[model samples]
Target: MPFVDIRLAGNATREQKAAIVADVTRSLVERLGKPPAAVQVVISEVSTENYGAGGQLVADRAPVPKMGEDANAAVTSR
Candidate 1:
């Protein structure tokens, strides 16, 4: 049996999780010759307050860049 564990900082949509599971199962079936039914995939969502990096919690980390914004323009406009 192949066991896969996925950890995320936030929740994902049902479609997203379905895609993940499909891709993971495909990979395991192809590479490890494992049956799809024998593969185990678990997705764990961790709260930002409970996750940390570089001595700071995820909730206190730097902000992410906005989607569809140019890096240079975003910086200059800030």
Candidate 2:
């Protein structure tokens, strides 16, 4: 059996999670010769407020944008 544990510091839609699980299971089946039913995948979504890096909480590091602000602009500018 192959166990895959994934932790994300944010949320994902149901469809997204399902896709991830399917992809992970397929990978295990193909690479490790594990049966699909024997592969286990656990997805955990941790709150940004509870997840930290670089001595700061993720929520604090990536604050929500104010109204009318383009969120992608910051990433593009960087």
Candidate 3:
């Protein structure tokens, strides 16, 4: 039996959560040799403001000046 717990920032759509569960189950079954029915997975969503990174709360992360531009640059540079 395998139990997996995921804690992430809250606010996900129904389809998004379903895909997460499905992918996790598939990984456990294929990679760990666990039966689909034998693996247990739980997801706990918390407020982004409650989490912190780089000594600053998630809410404190400076908002990007332009949406998608920085993300595109990062992807292309890599």
Each prediction's Cα lDDT score? 0.87, 0.88, 0.80
Model 3 worst lDDT run, 10 consecutive residues: 59-68
Q: State the lDDT of candidate 3 residue by residue for 1-78, as single tens digits.
A: 999898876577878888899999999999989989998888888887998888988776655344647755644554
Ranking of candidates on TM-score, top first: 2, 1, 3
Residue pairs with backbone atoms closer than 3 Å in model 1 (clashes): none
Structure candidate 3, residue pairs in collision:
none
Candidate 1, residues 1-70: lDDT per residue as tens digits? 8899999986789999999999999999999999999999999989989999989999786555669766
Tens-place lDDT digits, model 2, residues 1-78:
788999988899999999999999999899989999999999999999998999998987745565898998756665
Question: Pick by lDDT: which candidate is best?
Answer: 2
Structure candidate 2, residue pairs in collision: none
Residue 75 CA displacement from its true place in model 2, Å: 5.6
* Candidate 2 TM-score, C-alpha based: 0.80
- Name model 3 segments beyond 4 Å from true: 63-78
Better of 1 and 3 by TM-score: 1
Candidate 1 vs candidate 3: the lDDT winner is 1
RMSD in order of candidates: 2.8, 5.3, 5.4
